[model samples]
Target: MAEKLTDSEGREDLVYIKTEDGSYRGWRVDLLIDNLSSKMEEKILLCSSCKGMLRDACFYEGDLKCGVCIPEGVAWQPVKMNREIVSDKMISCPVKKRGCEWSDTVSTVMHHLEKCEFFPVLCPLGCVCLDGERKGKVMKLERKLIPKHQRDSCPLRELVCEFCMNTVKGCEMNPHLEICEHFPLLCPNRCVIEGEEGTRQVKRRDVSVHLANECPLQKVECPYWIYGCREEMERKEMNLHEREFLHIHHRLSITDMKQKQIQMSKDNKLLEEKLDTATERIVLVEKNFESKSRELLTFKQNQIETSKQTIDKLEIATKKIAFLQNENESKIKELSKVKHMEDKLDTANIKIENLEKQISKKDSELKSIIEVLYSHISLATGQLEWKIKGVKQKIENKESSYGDPFYVGLYKCQGNIEWNYDNTGKVVVAICIVKGAYDDKLHWPIIYKYTFILLCHINSYYNYEITKQVTKEDLEKYPNSLKRPTEMRNDGLGTRSLISNTEILEAKYCKEDSITLLIKIELLPAL
Candidate 1:
């Protein structure tokens, strides 16, 4: 029968029955119950009477049967059943006996056993001990047990002195430290105090007690107990008094005296050497000065001779300079004359240039006049040729029956000219035609008769008469009247009167028949 139980901590409890002893052990319930049940089925045989479901069965607890079915006075005994052993596997508890009944699982049982406290832990150094403290004790015992031959090979066999604590060979520490002062000595005074002040005037035997309480010779850092005292003091009265009353200046004065003595000795030695050197230098300088003075005298004599020669040469140079000066004065006078001549020549050249300009201007004027005359002659010749040709053609055209007149008359009359000045300083010429007789017959007799008749007829027709307005004095003053016929026409003369007036010159009429008329005009220079 499976029993359901709980532990004190309220966890499910399991019971395992040992096959050999039939003893039970409790564990925390796990899933191994299913395996246990399956193993029990494989081990237990089924009964044939009830087909594995018998109601009353005989099972042994010890070796006795059930009390109910047995005779009276029979005792019930507990039996040890082989629990139907599944596998004889010895598994250790996983909890290492720390109040747990859990056995190690098959997969982790070896590892759990290795770390288990129930499994003895050995030293890593191979000592037969469980921990470091026991290992150390074991090593100490091993060292003690070693024989002298082994002990010589053991590093820990060497002994160290108690006082100096230096390692030495076995049994040699006492002799080695015999000279060491730190060897144990019984001192009535412990002398625990440190420093020089604690040792002064104190007896060696009582040093420790005195230093603990009353020793006054110790060296101490200053507590600055006095108002301005900052110096450290020795604990002894003598040292403190000495420090308070030491004569510092006396020592300094002694040192100063020694230094001054040394300096004076050096100065005296230097002065003596300088005196000897100065005396030698003075003697040398005096000799050098005497020699230099003699040389200077010789040089001065030479300089005097050279100066006399220079003075004579300077006199000769002075005479030559005076002569040159006289020559230079004469040359300067000649140069002044040449300069004056040059000035006069410049003035003369200016005058000559003006005269040349005037001559050039006159020549230009003459050329202009000649050119005018040539132009007039050419024009006159051309006109004369044209008039002659015309006259010859007219004569040739006349028939024999029609008698051609053998004589032809041409006349030119010049009036007397007058001059007048305008405001611009230009001269003006005026000429007037005059009435005159020509040839034996009255010149222009027909034109004169026509002029008179026409004038009378013009007076009758217009009831006004034409009269000669220009006087003879006016005609004489402007005698060259024929030269400008327009001026005569402006006198209000009839055309027949103009014709009769033009015939007044006999020479002009004769030349008209014999020679062709040539009118030549030119501009003449202004008067």
Candidate 2:
């Protein structure tokens, strides 16, 4: 039917046709339809029950119905909504070389690339200048801005300092302002005014003047300076000095007041004008008072008349109030009933809360019991990690083998242990029995099997231990592990757990830039 109603005539190469074999076939639609179905009338199919527009309509039980409202055993074949294929070629993002992961049709590629995270964005700052390694230059457009990381706070952008008149990079601008000599700096003296600290902002260059000369703490001449008081002190100190010399200060104040009086006499005309102004205000106030008195008398007469009327109203209102009071009493009775219900509700709520707490407590107890059981089960499988962590902490804290050397022999035989790393960064722990360490108390040819354990401080599960079974004959024969000394001299207790440096560096055993490891030197139990 599409071919019968075909619009393409000259573009035969672009047209596609499907056969009974159903093999894959497609072509670019070189021509689009123009003025299709000109003679046909338009009719819209809607769902019978819901009134929704339906794509395909069919007759069901003698009534036209949509797919959604179709009766049982009724079906319809939908005419395909036709769309012209614009292009078969797919275009990848231009930033594919730079690492954008989008590939779509040419029409959609640009839209996807616009919002892609890896899409390259030029600085909105417009200037190509940069501060770091790319100094005064810009990289390729494909180099994407890290979205929020660089745009708002572009460190490479140039900024000028308001003070000192120097150009600085935005990254260094704050530090430059902090240390700029001409920058406005706050006074550090913290002058107190009415129990609050007062700060005066001044240029950093003038901070010394502000602190030493112009500050409130700076010394000043006394108020009685011309009166032969040779005291120069701080404002607070000058106040104290004036109090101590109150008699002299009073005499100076009296003379100052006499001088002020002389100055005041020259302003006699000004004082006369002020007196006239006060007299006019007095006359106005007296006139206002007379008017207010007349108004008050009339107000009192009206209040007496209103009070007589209010008495009659009050008697009638009293009866209504009594009726309202009775209604309020009835309401109070109902409120009491509600309060009783509320009390019952509160009691039920308290009981529910208690039961919830009890349920939560039982749940927690059950969970803890299950955990304990699991822990017991794990212990049977030789998971002694918890105990091992405690033991390792004791060794790391020097609490395990402090005063006495860790005994590594039968019958209180002692040995010293110290840690050191080899040239390859392998953690090498050297265990040795020093010369004459419990030698006088022991007989010659001492034989003891020693297991050197290096416990990982991170957790107790990782144990790097080596056990060496020593015979009286083998002790004299070996080079590293302890030897039966003839004169009770020193012997090295061999290295164990030769882990690679890369593994050791990243291992959880490394703590505080140094590895915390446990070394246990227990005298092997005798057979």
Candidate 3:
């Protein structure tokens, strides 16, 4: 039977889907096997657990199970009959709806896809000339249409320049001709110079320079045009015109110079008359200056007598100012002493404010210390007892109970009572390593030994003491459990099955649904 497959769009039973290898796309199996064939007895194999189609890639022969379903430990095996059936079954082409009238077995379909005309392909030159988001992107055209795309629309398609006959890309042809030195161009003037017999073609880049200097037909003015000749001619004919009119141009230049000389003589006479008038004005100014000088001398003599009288009075006033300055200096010194005392008073106030801040900080630290003392009881030096309530209830509810984090010297830790932490059917006690305030000063990875004690409510002799030792080797082996904690706490290290549910009631370790845990930490020398 021929089965029909449809894509997401459900249009024409064919759509292009690109695979990683850029070869055959989606596998649409319209499998039709002959019932009379000997190999038709086999059926498709599937995973027993996931029910996924199984292939050779997932077949695990060592444990007789599918690799994809191995986590569930489901036993399955690939059947030889399934591979035989697949290799012999006839499947229609992937692009059958795209006018590809081809069909083959699964074994030869991969090879047939390479030559299929209806198979979709990408532009081979997209990476070379396409820009931005289109770089290296797929073209999604049939295999037969690739040639037309490359020839018509591809920017990298090679083209021959009509002017220079040079090879260039289609997109770059226009810009190339703009700067192409060998490109041919017609002369604007269309001049015909003697002894040169060729098309009046000029290169695009050199057109301006040729018109200015090399083009014989370019319009130019005569050399004597400034002297009223007013003649324009082609560049090639300029020499002949200049030779023929040499005598006439020289005559015109001589007559102009003679006229200029006559005008200069009249200008010289006018300047001499102006100089005589200026000399007469200077004589009148000197006479007035002498008269003013005599008057100024009389006024200066009178001012000198008046200055002497004013100087005597100023000398007497200067002596009185000197006495007043001495009195002002003494008053300034006294004012400075008062200002200095005021400055000392301000300095004392600043010191008093600073002392008050220090006292407040000390008081906060003392309050925290008092809280720590009330939170837990201490049996001896370096030994702390944390009272954890609701221990029995937490065990019955299968919940873990933890005491508040406390510091033992430089190390911070918490006491935990976990129910069946390791599936041991018993209550376990653990100590968590918390990030401490003094971790920076302490040696790391931390090296220490701690004694965890489960105190008996009835007698001290029945108490359970478990010692956990941490060394450099232990930190290296289990760094996450024993290293300097980077977060709030590290994984807990403790004893498993400190007391079973039955044994806990018999031993009387728990009292009134509460338990007391004592921890003694000992610091070791750093290695």
Question: Measured by TM-score, how close is model 2 to the native structure?
Answer: 0.23
Q: Candidate 2's residue-wise lDDT over 1-527, tens digit each?
A: 11201221222231233323432122221222221233221122233453433334455665444454444455565433311122223445544444556656534543575577665455654445454433565432433465443555666667779888899887788889888989976666655445556566678889887766667767688878876567888765766787789998888878888888888987987889999999999999999999999999999999999999999999999999999998998899899899989999999999999999999999889767755654443212111111222333433343322223443332233333322233343434444554543344443344444555545666777756666655555555754345444444445554534454455445565554455444444343222
Model 3 Cα lDDT, one tens digit per residue, 459-517: 89989778877766666776787678988888777667666766665536777776787
Flag the better candidate by lDDT, 1 or 3. Answer: 3
lDDT of 2 at 80: 34
Q: lDDT score of model 1? A: 0.39
Q: Clashing pairs in model 3?
A: none
Candidate 1, number of clashes? 19
TM-score of each: 0.20, 0.23, 0.42
Give candidate 3 misplaced runs (Cα > 4 Å): 1-88, 91-104, 107-120, 126-153, 157-169, 175-182, 191-196, 262-310, 321-527
Clashes of each: 19, 0, 0
| Candidate No. with top TM-score | 3
Candidate number with the higher TM-score (1 or 2): 2
Whole-model Cα lDDT per candidate? 0.39, 0.53, 0.68
Write candidate 1's Cα lDDT for 365-396 as tens digits.
97677556544432221101112222223323
